[model samples]
Target chain A: MTTEVLTTTGAPLLQVRDLQVTFTTPRGRVRAVDSLAFTVEAGRTLGIVGESGSGKSVTSLAVMGLHRDAEVGGSIALAGQELTALSEKELSRLRGRKMAMIFQDPLSSLHPYYTVGEQIAEHYRVHFRSGRAAARRRAVDMLGEVGIPEPARRAGEYPHQFSGGMRQRAMIAMALACEPELLIADEPTTALDVTVQAQILELIARLQQERGLGVVMITHDLGVVARVAHEVLVMYGGRAAEQAPVDALFADPAHPYTRGLLDSLPRLDDSDDEPLRAIPGSPPSLREPAPGCAFAPRCAQAAAGTAQDRARCADVRPALEPYRSPDRLVACHFAGVPADAAGRTPANVPVPGPATVRPQGTDPDQEVSR
Target chain B: MTTLKPAAGPAPAPADGSAPPLVSVRDLTMTFPGKRSATGRRGAPVRAVDGISFDLAAGETLGLVGESGCGKSTTGRMLVRLLEPTSGSITFDGRDVTHLSQGALRPLRRHLQMVFQDPHSSLNPRQTVARIISDPLLVQGWAAGDARRRAAELMDLVGLIPEHIDRYPHEFSGGQAQRIGIARSLATSPRLVVADEPVSALDVSVQAQIVNLMERLRRELGLAYVFIAHDLSVVKRVSDRVAVMYLGRIVEIGDKKSLYEDPQHPYTRALLSAVPLPDPAAERRRERITLLGDPPSPAAPPPGCSFHPRCPKAQPLCKTERPALTVAAAGPATREVACHFPGD
Candidate 1:
């Protein structure tokens, strides 16, 4: 199933397993991400979709070795090299060269005083130990590569001088300056307008194609997921609700939370005659230890299920396991059960739209063969 | 414009476009004085809402959509009289309320209310949900007991547990806090509600819940709405007619069906195309009209069309002469587009 594909001489670009991130807050210990697992192969984009406080950003920060105060556990490997075992010094060496992340806000992510060009040049010099002249040239080249017109003039301008879209493009240029093998973008286009968002998404798609980079796009927008992701990992209540190929995830979501999310979206192409089947309750709080399933309280299927089914959901924490097919994993008690016996909402989420409207971005062969 | 407080009129004749509109706005404009320089020289005044006119039939939702700083929010505020317009007329229920003083505007406020974006920030964190919802009713001379009871009912109306009326805003989730905001907006049973990006801050699942609730309330209460948001899909779901604004002017206005399927204005086409569809195959098949650059600042908007700088179909005449919002020359007669080459 896995080739260590795309660019030659790679041992699985990025692999994460049993990843757990916890924080010591004033209130108490908060488990931001719990028992989440996913992999990103070279030339393929892995989308991490979740709501606010679902630990999407936490997972990205952990991958980039940026979580200093938080307690991070479990294995995070890049090209078969263990990252959790690495020290601060070693991790710093790997950060910009091995992996880089772009944040939602470009203005704050960048320094206000420094020229955009200088920041990119400095980042390049830190990672590659290049001199001023060479790093400067590299920064301009990256700026031009990212489709920034008049790169020479724009590079000298400060972040505040650039518009929102231009600032984001500059941020992308800075992220790709060293040509990192892996890129983790956390809501990269959330702050920009829809027009600008499309341009940035297109730019990212083109750059990924040209460089064959392993990309992890974290966002709350399902439309972006449908457009860019080869595979999707849906996070809920600090846990992986479901993980599957983009088409399967959208077409036939196995987890109740996943189904609720898909049904909840008011699509542009679809008619809005029927009331959206919104998930009934708010997101779960991570303060307490969840002995049973994290989503049992809000899962509509469990609510409509039998006493035995409800008890199983509330008493046992369902493990992330293969459902129907090994490639599609679902964390739910009633995943593979018959539709009529179990509630119909969970397993039968696909509205006969999968085959006819399958997104074209989930071609694994192209990613592998390129 | 100081007419006696007339009786709260009967629920406006069901829209049908035949009856007089519940709200009629013409040539509305707001000019916010620019910030002063270090030398104390004031900059050019920002014309936030340029000359824009529209009619909102009773019980109909007119969605206002545009990018940030495009004046959709400004237009919404003007409708509610939160920000007084520098020039133009605003007639509500056949009465001119454009320049009504705060004292004179108080009675009319019961018929018009606004739901702001960022529910948490808009709501007072210190106040309990009961007090928050009942404040409007109390101001309108309802007895204390009656106002509080109505507050509880409003909470239940918006799907919140009435028993938890004493809970503070922080105790609730993002979705629940927004429900309180909605409850507060509907407190006085306003006939027209101007919601400014009500669901943008909410998660997708919760956004759906709120949208459905709002739709139901509008239907059951015979309410009209001016839904202002940046999200096209949500607006499409809730609106009967939609107006697209760019740089302080509405570039396009039409029925939701006509606007979505066949956008006439170049900027509208680009904006609609920019909204990524959830369907992947459709995304692959459709062509996107990517605007060349960002929208020009309203402080110094382009001379002719505000969109001329980035417009793909802009001509020499477009650069020199401003295009007025007029009926499209071709295609759907159901729309008014402000472009030199609409439906080209």
Candidate 2:
């Protein structure tokens, strides 16, 4: 893979620092994203993964300058240009040309009344000021580039006329029409089936290879991150819980939240009948987060720790810093604890049954009495 | 927990055997009207679920997995009597309930329940959680005090705090709302639950919690589940047997181990290969079988085998002769597939 080579060779195309997004609601001020930071280099993918209310989508929206009413703070830069300092007019000019975004539901994101070609051409014409005919031709070319069959005829159809996968392809064609340097895809394949998801992911990876585009793929599926992302950022309670290379994050996750997520996932290859280790509590409320670690209340390690360790967890928040490995960053106080030492239950280890009972995996013996 | 176990009796026979299944369908089919054809005449009907048959045993999960529009949801609705089947017979516990009138179905409704996909829309926002969970009991003629007590117990069984029973659906998160939905489905202590894409709309972590809860309930209550989902991994976790559907037909049906490990149908193989595993090493090393094009529309399906267009192992016979599901040469003797060439 050229991902490792491309990641270390050049400056990051997108850098976010101390980003915070808060929305004023009727109940109170909701801090959706708090002090989140990450960088994405050209020709590489940075996958942001979390459950609902984890601020992954909010961070993407903040980078795209799409939040009109919410209060956004901190720094966001694109190719040496500070996005936070740019005016609305300047940001609009840079949106489709320099950076673009694709949403999860293509049907809702796309205009229902307009032809698919007209939408794509309009997106291209806005930035290039090209003739209508030229833009239309580019639209057809882009539709073909995304592997949509019969591009010329399909381009004339409305969003409703196309299938789910084709609509997503048209959405991608529109996003890439202007040749943006950065692409922020928020759950691009989350709405599609597994087969279509694989196709869309392959298309994105191929396009990124050809254009060296920086990609920020936001999704909740860790399998997707393992397949496509160069680096991964795990979020919890509107903050970054852990960040590491894709392989490292999967092989040995440092934070308890990440570990719980991995253990909870039911693997297709695994055929064991053991119960899944579900995370005990739901996600925290972002409006009034815990004073210390956001995940401390639900974390198994924090519950089993000594009084001093528990006090530190409840009183002082831990900062995201390097743990053991320089490339891997974790926000947990006991990040380096071994799995068994942290009271993590080993999965798929069979326990002995009652003396009179037969083993679980084998067929029940008819001779055994009740 | 030990007292919860039933008497140690002989293992139940396969639902496909001569013994009657808890829920049985013979030649089930459903079709919807479509637009006119190019000849300006009435077009062919859209075959949502065309001539499919399967069975659900007591205390067993039968996973129906397919892509969107494959008619899995339509089949689920038919089993629960929510939709009138175009043509077929549904035998429940030796009684034919296919075309029963609404008045006659009232008594049978207590034995079957359904859980929908979108928790937000499935639940009524105006109603309180207590009212939602107790509605089934109320419909069944339970007293008000008894129904409320049952609803509270159901809430605790599904891991929801009892104090939040009075709150409306809008107050809970997606996961909590799904728990409420589960509680409502179990309010009648139904024998069969047809969950149509229940956890697909939830987050991955919350999805695990719901799956675990459903598994535990099945064990404790001895409830049979018709688990329908597009996620193969999730289906594998919950299903004892699985039936893979494509273009409104069953392409393969077998035990979970046989179907996943040695899929006989080319479509099943492609679908399994497309799923991304969380292991980076395995993902990088595995070879993928990408199908050529999108599924053909059900209204205008191909002449012979519907999967011929995208099948990698398609032959000339596949274009002219429709295959029938039969015992496969490989795997278990009970395993069945509708492919001419059953194995790689």
Candidate 3:
């Protein structure tokens, strides 16, 4: 069973085992990713969802073998190849060839002077050992695949000439140009307006289906996760608080922190009456080694005799275990609610609607309950 | 010629038979001088804000929604004469203050205030909350003795402790610093406040708290607001009416529900469809209207309708003619759209 879980049809697309990423700054040593472990099966999407400072980016960076000033521990295997053992030059060779990443902001990731075609072709040349003319032709074809109209004309225009959405499409095109086995997208659509955001989501979805690629999407948004992710990993202060199938995680979150995050999100169809329940307190700073559970400071479930509970959460460090079914794994001390809990039925469970919708933008209605 | 008026203080026993809007912006147009490219030749002048017009009732909240570079922020700054408009007029209390000189606008500044996006950058680094809030009152020449009292009241109104007034801005959280900024904006008793992305920098929970306070203050003080933001969902929640802008033009303007539930303009519909729904079931069912390309450069917008290149309903006429802002066939006073084909 362990072998079957670890390897699918011989080798999993990407395997992360006790991956730890730490950064040393003037302030102190920050453990950005804390003993995190997860796997992304081929032709599937695994979402790592957390708020700012939750170490989502650090984890993805560690997977790409990209963090410069950080100490990395544990093993990341791609198609059974251990990436940590590879030399810098070897890793560089594998970067665009086997793995690719798309950043949140296209404007920052893309060079202003180069045309979209040139940048995509540059990545292709670095990996494929193809002729420049052949690379440019491939770049234009990839651009068309990402839904950019008039790829031929657009290939000649510089990055500055493209709008926010178009630039994002160009970024996706570059990532796909290499035909990598795995793709890492870090909030790739956060900076875009929703209309463009939806298009990008669809584009990624369609490409992933067509390519049979494993995708690791990192975002702070739960909504995006619900739409695209097949499996979910809920992280808090660098640790995976809970992991399960997308529907199962939302239907019945095992961890208190996961429960809190789910409650905080404003539902789109919410009626204008329910008062929003904001998660109390803030995420703890990770400047030093944590004493107990990192979520204890903000968690409401902690009690005086919780020192016993602390032993399990803080000292023991709960491992992921099957909760509902054999497939669903949750890493919480209290993996599932007791059978007699009052809020089990749909009538009692809070169905989020518009009234409790929390505003996510810079618009002024921040406080209006409606 | 209808004149705009500054939001008056509690009416003095009903002297005037009727009250007009606090700030009336009639066909306001703002054009900025764009720099020439490396070719040493001038490019088309950028219309940061084109002929856009709106009225701010004495105490109503008007939300301006658009993507970045759509000129909502420029429009906010122009309302208070921060950026001088090339044409049209902004009347404050029946006075045309659009082209008012800096010196002449200073006194009028007491009645209009702004809350900027970055609290840390907006607040003076060295100044304490007391000083920050008191600066506006002091600039209006309030006596030093009375300034502290008014500042304390403003701080308490925004839920900041009066005792912490002497603490510097760096000592506070993002939410706290924003409260300090809000305290300062209200210190002068400004009737109209232009808040540009006030809560975008804070956490979800903290954002809720700050937004709630703003709503409470709006009701209690009966102050008007020209709220500018990119988040349409939040705009729909708080605004009585929302105006959608694209390439320096108001593509659609309607009451919150109508604009959101039944957006007439194709651009407005596309914008609404972009917002991701939280529910797994609902999200899967919703048909998203995706725009194909990036918005055209505002500097050299498409010749006909600025949005024609990316607009889904664009026709031959749309490619050659700029559509005028007019009432939609749906015929709601709050529902006016500028489009060749306004689809609900």
Candidate 4:
């Protein structure tokens, strides 16, 4: 049966609120994503930045309704239509029609045996119920739109024959063949070289402007986000550590984790020989999270703070709320506190001893056992 | 930084007005046979590395930056003797080790080592951390007990707790595992370390930790590094001098500051422009030189200049004649660039 899809006036193209994804493993129930919320308007990009196991990919999968075995709880809306309440068939109809996704590696994503043109044509045929010749012609047009030279000749080649960059372009072409209004690209440029990455990003930007498509760009590289994203969301330990407009996030990061991430990156423009301020501890395990704030144990400010402030950090979980600016949100107990007032200690500052002692229970092995 | 005594050897005669470099490579080339074409005939050989030359001084870092398939990895592999070069001369510590057999190269192997890209696969999953870190010493015929002790020390040096030395590589995170790889590479106190994209696979925070540790190790132990990576920013932080490779050839080589601030070659400029700065203000304001197409295939590189097809400022001369690596007239003579039109 067709589901009633409502279109709200002035609503975002995609809206996610209080999203949580929990996976049932043999060991226990693991929380892959926790309370992730964001919105993407037409022709704008919202970048979800995080390291491995921070739930960025899981969030995307949950949005796409691809998490078959996981327990997904939250509100995900596309053009004001509630997606979590829809049936599998209804979701499938919307997946490649109203929304599309491209992954990190195009080699595995594209079919090896079929011709590139045939694959794109099939993608189009399934969605639009078009004739084979018409679908083929559309595929060729798409290939040319993506800047592939001699589209008709190249479309006959198999996935194996295409180069890495060309293969990615073909994937992009297939994704955009139906002209979806929303696109989710998970680490699309991670596998590509710098030059090719620039080209692919440029292509996606140009297409987004042309189609007015809402794009969700997922990557661990902050540089990528700075270049293309209008807004940024920083994820840590399966939660949004910080979220703000790209300019605000870079200029005045509220969360200590966000500050640490930015400070750690080696800048090409900076010629300083000083050592980088690396975040002290590894990421926490999702199976059993720490007591209060997930980042507290490794945060230098938390370590060096007054006893009362440190106790509050260890006992109370901070909610994602406005910090410094109305648009900026941070999940830290002392989000807007100045560095000196918060007792912030410089990272990588040499301890006056043989070797610095690691904070208790911060080790990955210890966390796994606990 | 404490000064460590140089390894004992007959110091070679001063070359080019200074002490001879610790490792010198000249005219290095590596070609791999390509697959057969549709006509059932073998295709041309892929020139993975083509006549590239460089020198690494003691305790210095020479960064090799390039995109995928640009022979940066191949060049790193050749330096550590992991792969045999089709043609080249590799001089190490005043001795030519280019043609040395495996048996003959054993003694000199202690002076050269490599840290691979993937920490997960580079390390043996089944082996204990101690065994993994001490493998070099064990190969060199060190006693098992001594090797274990040395491995413990190395763990401490790389910031891993000594108690976890008995754990497997699977027990550690990506960054920790990379540290184990670094510790293993330094087990024999090699004069030169070829790190192939060592930090690329790690998280940004963890990457800084590893970079700091490597920098500290370079000062403490006086180890030379040939840091190869695709990230220009990371390379700039750790390298004294940088080399830009494109289509199996070095397009530019100069001091890190000079090359980054005043890049001569168009390819080098394009590469620098392509890197997205973390600062949004600068990134938005930056004038990006978007290259048109992917780099030409290494196996069938374009005639004359391989980059001529994509170069924005390409001329007829670039399409007909390949430019040799030559010193630019305006800059320091040591700053060499392989471009017909050297400057903007």
Clashes of 1: 0
Model 1, position A164: C-alpha lDDT score: 91
Model 3, A91-169: lDDT tens digits are: 9998977889999999898998888899999999878889999999999999999989899999999998888888989
Tens-digit lDDT track for model 4 on A164-208?
899999999999999888999999999998988999999999999
lDDT (Cα, 0-100) at A324 in candidate 3 = 73
Query: Residue A339 in model 2: shift from native, Å?
Result: 4.8
Top candidate, metric TM-score: 4
lDDT of 3 by residue, B1-344 (tens): 00112346433121122667677887888888778879988777889888997766777788899988888999999997789999989987778999989898889898889999888899999998888999988888989878988887777678766777788887776777888899898888888899998877776546656666777677777778888888775676567678999989889887776677778899988887777765566678988878876766678888888898888788999999999999877656667788988874
> B1-344, model 1: which lDDT tens digit per residue?
01211234335453446888889999999999998999999999999999999999877899999998899999999999999999999999899999999999999898899988898999999999889999988889999898888887777677777888888888787788888898898888888999999999988877888898889788777788999999999999999899999999889999898898899999989998899776666677888988877877899999998899899999999999999998877957778999989985
- The CAPRI-style docking tier of model 3 reads acceptable
TM-score, predicted candidate 1 vs. hidden true structure: 0.92
Ranking by TM-score: 4, 1, 2, 3
lDDT of 2 by residue, A1-370 (tens): 3334435645568999999999999989999999898998888899999988899999999999999989999999887679999899999999988889999999988999999999999999999999999999999999999999899999999999998889989998999899888999999999888888998999999999998989999999888999999999999999999999999999999998999899989899886579877765567778788889988766656655655566677768999999778999999888968544434333423233322223343211111100
Query: Model 4's DockQ?
Result: 0.58
Poorest 10 consecutive residues by lDDT, candidate 2 chain B = B1-10
Candidate that beats the other on TM-score, 2 or 3, i.e. the better one = 2
Q: lDDT of model 4 at residue B163? A: 89
Which pairs of residues have clashing backbones in candidate 2? none
- Deviation in Å, model 4, residue A366 alpha carbon: 11
Pick by TM-score: 2 or 4, better one: 4
Task: Give the CA lDDT, 0 to 100, for residue B321 in model 1.
Answer: 95
* lDDT, candidates in the order shown: 0.85, 0.86, 0.78, 0.86
